[model samples]
Target: MAAFDGSTDYDVTLEIPVSIGGLELPNRLYRAPLLEHAGDDDPVDRLLDELEPCAEAGVGLLMQGATPIRGREGRAAPGMTGFEDPDRVASMSRLTDRIDAHGSRIFAQLAHGGLRSMEVWHAGYRRRNPGLRQRVVSKPPLPLRLADRLGILSIDADPLSTDEVYELAADFGRAADRAAAAGYHGVHLAGATMGIFQQFLSPFYNRRDDEFGGALDDRLRFFEVVHEEIRARTDVPLVTKVPAETETPWFVRESIDAEEAIEACRRLAEIGYDAVVPVGSSPFWDHAIIRGEFGSRGFDDRVSRGFEAAFGGPWRRRLVELAARIDAATTPFEAAWNADLCRRVRAVVDVPVLCVGGIRGRSEADRLLGDACSMVGMARPFYAEPRLAARLLAESDATAVCESCNNCVPPQAVGEPGVCRTPAVLKQRGEFEKRGAYEREGGNRRRDSDGPKL
Candidate 1:
């Protein structure tokens, strides 16, 4: 059934298999978690020695970014990484035996920055709001979004009282059963930037007049009861990352439109959500429009064709012919226009469409496996080459150098960790302080005390 001609170059052992649930991923080229305030409290030998050179750099699905779940004022930092500590699940079983001995499949991005919790980057449990205001309330210079920086540090917000929003929908199904009992080959729900499911799909921090909020079906009824109690506990794999709308007017929200972000991707494809990733966040809504972010680049196939026309489905003409083969790239020249937009978004989405922004090397990872978007996420070139899929299968030019350097999503380096002032991550300050700051309390808002700092 070979029909994907986005331009062909993939063979990390013959690409093609993305399967999610019982973890199949051999190559779709993923390594996008970056946030390296690398899991604190005895973080297993500095996160398996910075993921053993990123699983000897052959990435196939090496996730793990946000982590924190069972509260500690719902962490976002103080150097994140706490799977609600049950004695730190053997630091994720020594990070799943060195990413399954380098074959690659480690998943764990489960976050909870709710209202973007930032007590000077999570110094720990300060949000105790009774709407008593004045924690230093000034806000309005505009760049304050993340539900107004989690309502000026009025944490553990009161609005969630529908039995604490069904006890945070069973604490997101017991934090996805503690990242699938810590073997993790599944569990990516950090619902983009102002995380905590985009602060329960923000209506500017859900004023919650009940059911959950006022509209957008009561703000996706607490994410459909935390995706039906984390898909009823778990068969592993879930991956959600939404927010193409509703955040102080970015993707232009009218009660979270685009048919409610395609009815929240047809309710994460009716709850068996294997993958969804859409992300786009620079104006305060989980951004979605990909790299350029002002809007339009296959904005997840015109918003998954409004969730394939509200689930009438035929995969909505394969997600609008993979957004006209990723709007036939007018720029980002090379890697055959990203394998013809991943062979025109895998010729219409049978479930694989991945691609995340400004890819790094191996000719954009061989046009991201010659254009079929099964995987190729790359958060800021894995904080300036974390062995980027092993220097792109050793064709090395330092994997065609990624000096784009926005300095991997800044925000005061969350408390400082992912320090790649380039020069190859500053010749390892003890592996950049044991691999930190991929983005825990960094850029999602903080510079405006009086604005100046660029």
Candidate 2:
């Protein structure tokens, strides 16, 4: 509970202020946008229940994970909650109050799955063609190598057109408007994982030859339109998650170089974005493992800080000061540094920074304030235990730990609403075994063939 042992200067009140548009935030700690397949039909409301716990955990900003804006997609998971209906808007409004009671601001991340949409898979494959052969478009199609990329087992991809693109952007804005109406602090665009945004941005995915394709500027147009719409319609903050660039063992072409990422960051700043979060394996490496590995070590932080460094503008300056403050702390990672990326963004433009990934301690909170981060975010750990942030700040003796179990990693290891199945989460989930049956099946089957969690 006490940030320090009377040794270093540690501030417990992580109520750091950050400004986005006209909104001022409380601190630098946040709950990363984590998807909880808690739907209208589920017996338990997964993410909705975590709001208060996360607020109690002292999260100044608590943002939920990618909730779809388009209702047509249906439920990827049997009970996935969505923002497509007016009724759900009221439900979210009530949910926001639960988080607000804890003094933490709440936001909903709006998204569309695009090519990687699980709904498309479920409906196209599971329901329509369970026994169909694999089908995929090869990046470099050639003899003897037709099946290069993993086939998603679906025949329902209708390449998006410019009009459709515009429509979707508006849909995103509409969702943002709804979230704002629901009293969310902000709404972030889920641009990662070849999501709708990323697919448009990446040449690997987008085949459009119109104004929405080609150059990076062209590719980023779809996002710009959506962002502009959100800003024009609502007063809520806007944040985006981008992949950083790194080239260690592999080369990531779309992975924007730090400098390019900075340029993009500056562009977003100019566009009036509150924060830009970069998540993934070294942004430098084109090789992303498991569709979710940021490498086991630095992962998200390294990409975030490193990218901020590459873009040394007003945004960079804010992030730098914030980073200095976070580097001063003794938490699992540098909260300020991660937040600094946002602060630096704030300095140049009129916005605040929000850091995310895997934060789970007050040490992180102290660092966020001490460093200068407007807000820091916790994801997987928080996903496993909704009240995790509260326990770290209020319960001094509480030594909660994320076993780094891959339960929360979706599409790569487990299913949606990844449960906490690590020894710790298992103890918490009670039905960890039942929940982790998939892992057990994969692990058991793999052991016979000498494989891994993939």
Candidate 3:
């Protein structure tokens, strides 16, 4: 059988080193940030052993995901670092030190889940309610008015006071300083709809009439100020993942469509973002981002749990499962699902653009790198093969074992690390997590005072 290119092969060795935000990464294969939190409280302890595999695999960079910035305001769940914890900096530095030892550049993905609260804002809602669309809290409740009319998860959020918004921007800068102290090569501030940064941008979440909302430019003030502040604080590279103007359903108040996303990429590029990663859908709503066959099906049990909690008839139970399945369904598996949008972003900015969707094996990656993208990121594939990068460099036909099952995702907030659920991968993940536990108690790793302070 003839491969698409008529050449049954792929290669990463010939790829050129590219500079993003002044950090010249060795190759284009990036270990996309996946939310593999190290249990609830001892993240720093388990991080080194958990991440050592990827660094040893010869990945160009390891982007640790969802490093929360503030205390209550930044955290989405336990195990996430908010940089406010006294011991977090020391723990983060230990993780970075391990990466440095393996010669892999590292970046902490800074984030704050804003209106997207883990705690239900009101008594009526459930945990991290799936689509908590809101109106400005000071104003009359909008989504609440329609809440009973529809079956979607709708709740009210306390809109940030103008003062609070500005303070959040300052927090981002401080967080970047902390990352630098931790020996990271860079930091990618998460501006996804799931985070505070996106809460300020998407009209779905931002409903204020003051300086922070209304027109697109007005809404963008937060992004501009936050990134500028981060630049002021650190010399490390800055990157972000955003919706890229992809249209999301009305119920999901966290995303803006395709054209809006293009404007977003251009605006961020102007503000000195080292790279912009454009995913297939808004970070919160679309199943396409994970490229799941059925709306992140192998995961999203929370959706059903929330629905069951809200309306618990046997009929509701059936409906809940059906809705979750339908909600997460997407197109068939295809490589570079976000390539088109990324190309548009590339045309607008000189900075590198990263496209992540389903760049499964070497072929898809090589194809996109040859086209619009500057780099490629794979999240699920890494779980299937931590050594996938090194393996691919040696064998063009080396494919990742990850079937995009997505079983490792929609993370276990309080429990286990979200490791690959495939039987074979599951076994390996158990062994890895066990060793990570041992390292946590070894008592010789770096402590808070041993690392730099912000």
Candidate 4:
């Protein structure tokens, strides 16, 4: 027998069929979960249009972006859908129908805002609840060790009450049922560190004396119950975006480093998760997820201006800018940034592992699928060009034109559908209207309320 040189199998590895639960994925390239803002956009028609190209491009697996479990409490952005809503189910059905036509397997990536809830920004939903960010944790829990306090882990956000935690678990289970009804092949829990699931799992933000708090087992108790409930409700595949490695050391250290993440993933896989998708700490280590030119935030011509406005003046404005700059500071753009992380994770779990980070084109995909991970997931590149996968598959030498500018991220960050700002997306009034801002043509006018929706 000949020695297996890595290059020989590169072409076929990504093309091979793999099974995710009962769902048979036709290829190794799954579209990373991303927001189409169909929840808030024209809901049905616009989502169909936005997803049409990706489907036509021939991706076999497409994970639709984050949908909140609770309509108001967990909404990270205004446009995010609560799949339970009748209008949303109809819309999801329409979009899923379009995807099925192209022989694609689609899943809804369900999320709960948890502590980072953008409920503060929701216009219709905001007035209903007392503002909770500061009040809930009016006193942010102090990190137990001096080492843990070194970075972004000091975030002072209120912890969910013991009841709220269990309620959230039930919400996720019911949400999964709704996702199945909406024509998705499976449901995904957004356990990435940025959202509530990770918040409950990480000690940095989850400081309470209740059963949901304390040791690692206690922190994960909420998730164990949620996982058990979701599995019982649906037989569809369940995937989770868990931390493989924390991006910046401070946030993912001690309790949940690379070793801890693997251990947790190993246990979760046993608990019934169909696959584990690994993510570096997001937002806090902004550049890790979306790398680009140094300090080049699209905020001035982008979404999130409303966030800046909340600061109210030059001092706060300067502070926000500095924070954004620090968070998004540049890292060298690389191919398959998370391949090694995925390789580490693939070693421990028996379930399929999906790796996504800094994957730009065919070459990177091949590099990643060559054994580092079972699948390669793409997000921003597709946002930059919907035909991204087709282009890569058609030409082995091809690469994405995305500058990795992170422009598309902010839109979905708040809950607006992605808008490619490269050649001026704002200039297209017809396209802009579907995204729910700009009442007229031309980029000349702006809406009375709401930041760019992300």
Specify the highest-lDDT model's number: 3
What tens-digit string does per-residue lDDT give for candidate 4 at 159-232?
A: 55667667668878888887787788898888874677776666665666888777877777766888888877
Worst-scoring 10-residue span by lDDT in model 1: 438-447
Mind giving the per-residue lDDT tens digits that candidate 3 earns over 129-229?
44443323233235534533344433345566788777778888888888888798998877773567776777766678888788888888888888878
Candidate 1 lands at a TM-score of: 0.31
Report how far residue 340 has shifted in candidate 4, in Å: 1.0
Q: Between candidates 2 and 3, which one is better according to TM-score? A: 3
**lDDT (10s digit) by residue, model 2, range 268-327:** 766666667754323211223112222222213433443333222345434433543332
* lDDT of the candidates, in the order given: 0.53, 0.52, 0.64, 0.64
RMSD in Å for model 4: 9.8
Q: What TM-score, computed on C-alpha atoms, does each candidate reach?
A: 0.31, 0.68, 0.79, 0.80
Alpha carbon lDDT at 143, candidate 1: 36
**Model 2 Cα displacement at 305 (Å)?**
40
- On lDDT, the stronger of 1 and 4 is 4
User: Residue 442 lDDT in model 2?
Assistant: 11
lDDT digits (tens) for residues 1-454 of candidate 1 = 3333444444422233455554676556677776677656677677776665666555667776777675454555546777766658645776786677667777887776654554322222343322231111112123344423533222333334567668767877887777777677777777767665665665654555666767666666766787678778777877766555422344433334334554564455454566665543422422233232122322343344433332234444354335434432322223222333334434433344455656666555554544445566766566555665544544433343444434333332234465345555455423533554221221112112332100
Best model number under TM-score:
4
lDDT (C-alpha) at residue 143 in model 3:
52
